[model samples]
Target: MRPRKLDQPRSWPFIVGAWFLRPALVMTTKRDWIDGLNIPATGGCVLVMNHLSHVDPLTAAVFTHDHGRLPRYLAKSGLFRNRFLGIFLRAAGQIPVERASASAAGAYAAAVEAVNAGECIVIYPEGTITRDPGLWPMTGKSGAARIALETGCPVVPIGQWGAQELLAPYAKRPDLFPRKTVSIKVGDPVDLSDLADEPQDAEVLAVATGRIMDAITTIVEELRGETAPPERFDLKKARARNGRPLEDER
Candidate 1:
């Protein structure tokens, strides 16, 4: 399979930050961890992460830098509409995907292409910021798994915390003062070699995605030492909406 071509360099700032700035910041409330990890400089791979706040992407970028690799990510189409930020996102090798469309197959394809091209593609499996009242990870979408199965790329489960403290969800701006510590944990690469020969099945893909997410959830609970909500993160809101009885009979 031909690898996807990433027409831009996204890891430049992260590389700069890690080499020059991360050291200074490491001293104050700073933390990061990786276990049984190996991030290949060239190859197709997916970095699946739990989302909390906007800072999630930047933190992941920093993780790639520290591990000596370039990272590409899928961003919502809305962010690319911005004049300046959009340019930066594009130059940094971010792929803009339209979620409202009937299908986001194009974006997923692009990610696969990047992997085939020997680049690391990052995806937030949750598909959006956690609405978890407690701000932990929510149930994830199956797109990440689909990409992994299609491209034969290893899915790397990532767990993150403290981005919410840097900038709480729904906050207008990030909190910069006390320099809150952020931790990123990378687990062993999830080998998808078994699925390479099998044709894609929705059920099989979902199970694969769920297994990867479960790994991430365990890490987050370990880091925070609290059990996450048992409900699948993605279905909670839809279930709530359906449960509400019809109202307002005039």
Candidate 2:
């Protein structure tokens, strides 16, 4: 089945503002960054990024549009609580997720359907903005891994810098005067096809998730010219004896 559309609230301005104006700003200030990068023009891919600020999503979406595709994001349900924003989000084909609800199944199902429909799904693996002091990407969750492993979709990892300064996560509002330049570096797509889809062993999932974050970290480090923590995720430790170590360790 195709994804649902908004039948209630009519918020065209928000869609235009979000999908058009914001992306245009990113292009101009960043010196047409998307035009300089190599992004695939077709296919059902997952754009994963480190969540430093709300602008992360907009930046990714703009890149997708520049490469000739529309992006569908899985957003927290809280954003939709406000009657106005809810209308706009729904109309734009954004997925609503209840981050703290007992029934997050609906959100996941929506994401699966969107991907199956050949839509580019944008997801923040961190699930929220990074709280690290340096604005680095925190330990990400396993949902993105699960999706990629299951669908065999190409997961495009993007490292975003400068978005935090453009619109700080906890700030009351963004600095609109000087027009901050946000940099988004898109990494090569990752294929999880080689990994098994069995979620029974938490160790397997942990290892896979770490690999996903590692790709994001590499891109971030290259873009910002700063090294991330030595250990982003301890999948081996998390797995204990169930973890798979290299043969060289033997």
Candidate 3:
């Protein structure tokens, strides 16, 4: 099938961001994008993906853009602190998420509004890069499920691998030699039908969140060609085991 053209004009910030990122991606990563047509050519939807490296966003954005949609990410609020970056992010139409705060409600509202208006929003349910020792997906937050339930839009799961090699989790430097192969596979919309009618209570949200994460993990397993742990890693447990303060963690 032919890819659809972007329905809206590209913003200057998105154009500029793509300009810088495209070359770096071409230089350092060989992309293997599969089943990209699974992403709806036009509509409001949530793209749920596992967070591996800082570079994954660039790769994912390119994949979505190539498929005719501009990805709007629910990014951490800290990135907007710099005046220039703040301006660019706003201009690029990225949503800022105030992690672990009451203000996060605003982000949720904005996401719902965007979805209802037929925009694609990307969410990393794990909230941050996986703290898993083996780089597997960890326990997810409930935002993605909640948003899907609220808007009744498609939630597309994507499994991505190889970005870690380009830039390891929390590593200061990126290795640009020998060009890494970045594999990304798109999965069908998650089956949230059973819980669609349920009230958006904690129990309902938890069940929906589990389904979303399970779908994403299954796709990741396919990309990695390995089995994930029977149980996902819990960040709270990891912190307690290491006796690290919550604020000190990333």
Candidate 4:
């Protein structure tokens, strides 16, 4: 079924996003957004989704938009280096993250602030497209857990599939003829209450991150109708095995 057109909110970013994304969505993929109402109508929240393909962001943005929330992604600082793209991203209120730098702390602070101010912050815990050969979720980073712990907001986990079929990871060409089915399943807010009041330590953060990734992996497993591997794939190890450097850390 075609997605129903909801009244666009009067925000410039929302307007611009819808203007370009809506038609592209209709033309490219058949969206299956399940449990969209799981997203709160009004409140500060964090959304953690597994990264599949480069196009996943656009598909995810469309899903979030259809659910009545404008997703503010923690995009890489590189995307903002382009003159025109930088202006547009800044105007859209997206946060720029400098990986492996002292300035990354500032990005974390900004994300916490955005959540406290009642905005939806979208984060890919894996920090890039999955290195899992089968495209299952891999080991997640601690950023999402840190933000959730700091802001005390709901961390909604989303599992998605099919974007890879349209544009496989690191592929130059896209298959645009037959529209693919982008299946998105939203899981309940991960329960971080147990660790909310606990001191933020490596152990606590790892536990919280595991919970978030498990939730995402479960949903993805359901969508694919297959069990995930016993252990989550490690990108670093994969790169080491291939004797290559990590290329896409977005």
Best by TM-score: 3
lDDT of 3: 0.90
C-alpha lDDT score of every prediction, in listed order: 0.73, 0.68, 0.90, 0.89
lDDT of 1 at 129: 82
Which stretch of 10 consecutive residues in model 3 shows the poorest summed lDDT?
Answer: 241-250
Clashing pairs in 1: 3-116, 3-117, 4-113, 4-114, 10-92, 43-118, 139-233, 139-234
**How much RMSD separates candidate 1 from the native structure?**
6.3
Per-residue accuracy of model 4 over 1-250 as CA lDDT, tens digit each: 3343444354676688778878987998887888987887778899999998888988998888778788899999999999998988888889999988898999999999999998899999999988788999999989999999998999999999999999999787989879999999999999999999999999999999999999999999999999999999988778888998764554
lDDT of 1 by residue, 51-114 (tens): 8877667766756755656678888888888998787678777898888575468887788888
> Distance (Å) between predicted and true CA of 96, model 2?
0.8
Better candidate by TM-score, 3 or 4: 3
Off by over 4 Å in 1: 1-29, 191-194, 235-250
Selected candidate, larger TM-score, 2 vs 4: 4
Clashes of 3: 0
Ranking according to lDDT, highest score first: 3, 4, 1, 2
Q: What TM value does model 1 have?
A: 0.82
TM-scores for the candidates: 0.82, 0.80, 0.95, 0.93
Candidate 3 stretches with Cα past 4 Å from truth are 1-3, 247-249
